[model samples]
Target chain A: MTSSIHPTVRLTSQQRLEGIWNKRTYTIVRLIGEGARGSIYLARIGNRYVALKISQDSSVISAEVNVLKEFKKVQGPPLGPLLLDVDDAYISHDLKLAFYVMEYIDGVPVSDWVKREGLSWLFPISFQLLKKLHKIHQLGYIYGDLKPDNILIDRKTKQARLVDVGGVTALGRAIREYTTWFDRGYWRLGDRRADVTYDLFAFAVCLLSLDPHVTIHNTKERDIYKVLNQAKSLKPLTPILKKALSGQYNNALELKSELGVINRKQLQPTKSNRKTATNPKIDFWPEALGLSSIILVHAGLFYFLFYRI
Target chain B: MHTGTIRQILLITDGCSNQGEDPIKVSSMIAQKGIAVNVIGVLDDDQTEEPVGLSEVNDIANSGNGISRIVYADVLSETVQTVTRQAMTQTIQGFVSKELSQIFGQETNEEDLPPETRGEVQKVVEDLGETVNLQVLILVDTSASMQHKMEAVKDAIDDFILSLQARTGDHYYSIYQFPARNQVVKELLPWTNDGKRVNKVFPKLAAGGITPTGAALKQTVKAFQNVPSSEEWRDDSDDIIDSSYGSSY
Candidate 1:
């Protein structure tokens, strides 16, 4: 209930979230945003800064935590760098809440930066976004929601990274939710999700926000009007994009493709789109080729200093 | 180091995986010498279209996931002298994708919530309001570990996107990626299930860069926006999103 208490920082009660970490520290972070299915935080652990989140309940949180643990086990060093040091311990809070900590982000959202810089955030970072999501999906968990904010783009490196991952919908949850409504589909014991299709839809919404086209609408309906007009607008894919764009057939796949539906493939343009991949005609995310992995390494070092500020 | 060869490799290609762009064949072929069978599928057109890999001796025919069809790749290896030879065959499981999931596996329906439960759900939801539609930001490591997993992730996300389309509410999604270099924001697809021209746009992706997760996160957050709506949304636009240093591993 608005976190019965206020976060130590004057960050305002965006919904104060304070919970226990190791019995000695009861974390207090200002609520930042409502993530996938719960609350997010910009917390202060003693003198250090972190982002925290508490999912709906212990069961759901456990599933996500378990997935996170699996992730901690399998991911490469460059993928979602394991942030939180998860623990199951009794806390200062009355209710036993599931909490995890992550490095605190210090920059403004790309949206604000776009508005501030007054430049199009599209075409540069958008395509690369899909590639990242595809990798996450490969890791065997659905991001459930893929949006700009969930993605943090470093100004120095100009690359994107994913965060706020506590909400992972497993196959069990999907089966539990759909047993009655749909009389079809086989149910697996610990499957991913029966309806991961929704991630694509969210992918579309995320893309539209970055695409300069949807913003031009300037109406309450926003992109809805353009979505309804998909019958006429979406011309055939442009040559190289043809490989990524053309998908499915007459059934729902064709329909999804035709409507410019945002799927994982459609979002991540390949090296051909890069400058010197020999396919110069297709200028996908050119900035990607010129940059180096060193930037993230530096960002890691820089952020360590930035967080201190 | 333990080295094993794959007797047969199966790929599900919905056009995500390149026909001959793979480097896993050596490992697989080596595994073949040990009489190991590996199945890979490259999903073609829809989950049903024929894939080229299905004909590579041990490959199975083209069949997409989510359709309830299964493709089987069986490998048989015979060691002759010091060398080993393998024979591979692919089979398709003829079953409606949904029906294959077995019976009564749907999620439990949310019956009229008991008053207390309803009240609690409503309170949390009300607290969330417009922000209920959270966003997902993706970070992909195009490193050596990223090769085979790339296409699989793309396919899984494609299915996930299709699944989220059924619900209502204003949800928005954006994509950005990094390897050694930074890729641009290729496409911004909005969340509208009207179907026609839905912007199912996946870019032509390949991996080359080192994993730059932190930089990628900053690049993505730079595109984040606070949609103006009358919901209990927390406004940090005034303060804003930051380039937080973090990674999944």
Candidate 2:
């Protein structure tokens, strides 16, 4: 029986991988990210480094590879890591693992970026992420697992990019992967069906999760709403998020437009309101107004990205 | 892509079968009818030694032509969804592999295909996986050893059904537990799409009985055939479960 095979592939430090199918060789650098389905390793294919995902289940490798392929067909900005290679390798005499290599984006996850840069970045980051989600949703797929780990912020350009398409399910199909915190079913708010709204719902949760104060317990609907409402950093966008969480927006486009309106509305008040900002009673308002100038630039970028698609 | 529906019997248990018939044999018979019998061997977190039923779980899956997983109770819901999706893709790959054999005039597995062709085949398989009608018969081992694990089992089933709503394919789910008070198997909830029906039945689930896995599996095969109640199981199936429970939310 194959029961004794380890759930994950553990290799010696700087292990070398020679593919059986493609006759390609790669040297491992280190483990990058580990998911429920597989562990991703940063590896050197030749002189260049690529992200390699190895799994015991060949179908998982195949499904994700296909998603990356689908990403290439989308007409806009790159959706995820580029698919480079797909092959199988022998870990032991009896154990063969299916692996696919992709172009590695050297960036921090969005959560880390938000923590480092502060709450103002949330608007621009969400704008970029919603654009990507809208593109994929147009192809009748939902980014089923839309947590922060799956979205990476480029170190130099500070642009948001999506990674890990393992949970990309067809819009109507059962969601194959999800995190408990981002899942609407776990919150007892909505069903787990893959749809445009499902990703939007998760997008709302993903945004909420950036706030260090917001933690969702596995019980009570009113308590979750209370916690989300009380978050100071997320207060301005709370109404938009609430609409998304309640499945008010029909598609990512509708959600994107609503978000665009908020950014614009946030921008209008900044110029006139800057003079009276030093008052102790309105300290929070000044900080919120400060984010508007950044939101204006991002709002323009959002339009460029929107029509170029 | 295979156009017909995919049928699966997901058997979840923590220990070995103690009475009635050989589960491996029953699984093989079920496999012969083109229904895969996937098994998940649930284990408690602190347990050290391997459970007695671990090998039996592998044997059943092997003979039944399905995937088998042994996971801790904490991750049961995730494993349940993964195994189900894996089984669907595996089944489709199997058919695609056979068709490839005819075209190439040699035995060729889908994985053995060149990477480009494999990607195309995988896309087809994934598309088919979404659209193909799926019917899963969930078999839970409700022996005394599994008493503490019932909460995890209940959550897993609920999660599984809720997850299925994302699929475009029509799904029919039914729950069957082994070793009812008198009989080998009892129907907790008949085939239904509403996951809420499971909430009603878990309250009635009392875990104190022998593990008649083989007999339970035999009854599962009969249930898949749409046989209402065979003579021996008819009397006990009526006592606790109301017929209305299957169809109602």
Q: What tens-digit string does per-residue lDDT give for candidate 2 at A1-309?
A: 122213456765588888998889989899988776778899997689899999766777878888888888987678888889888887678767889999889999887876655555666677778889888988888999889888998886677888889789887677878876777876678787787888988899888877765665433453457757746566668888899888899887788777767764442113322342222122233334567767988999999999899
For this target, which candidate reaches the highest TM-score against the unseen true structure?
2
Q: Kindly report which residue stretches of model 1 are placed more than 4 angstroms away from their true locations once superposed.
A: A1-29, A74-81, A88-93, A114-121, A155-157, A170-201, A215-225, A228-309, B1-249
Scored by lDDT, the top model is: 2
- In candidate 1, how many Å is residue B83 off? 60
Which number leads on DockQ? Answer: 2
Global lDDT of each candidate: 0.35, 0.77
lDDT of 1 by residue, B126-207 (tens): 2222122333323333444456555444543443333333223233333333444345222333323332323243344556
Query: What DockQ was computed for model 2?
Result: 0.37
Q: What is the TM-score of candidate 2?
A: 0.80
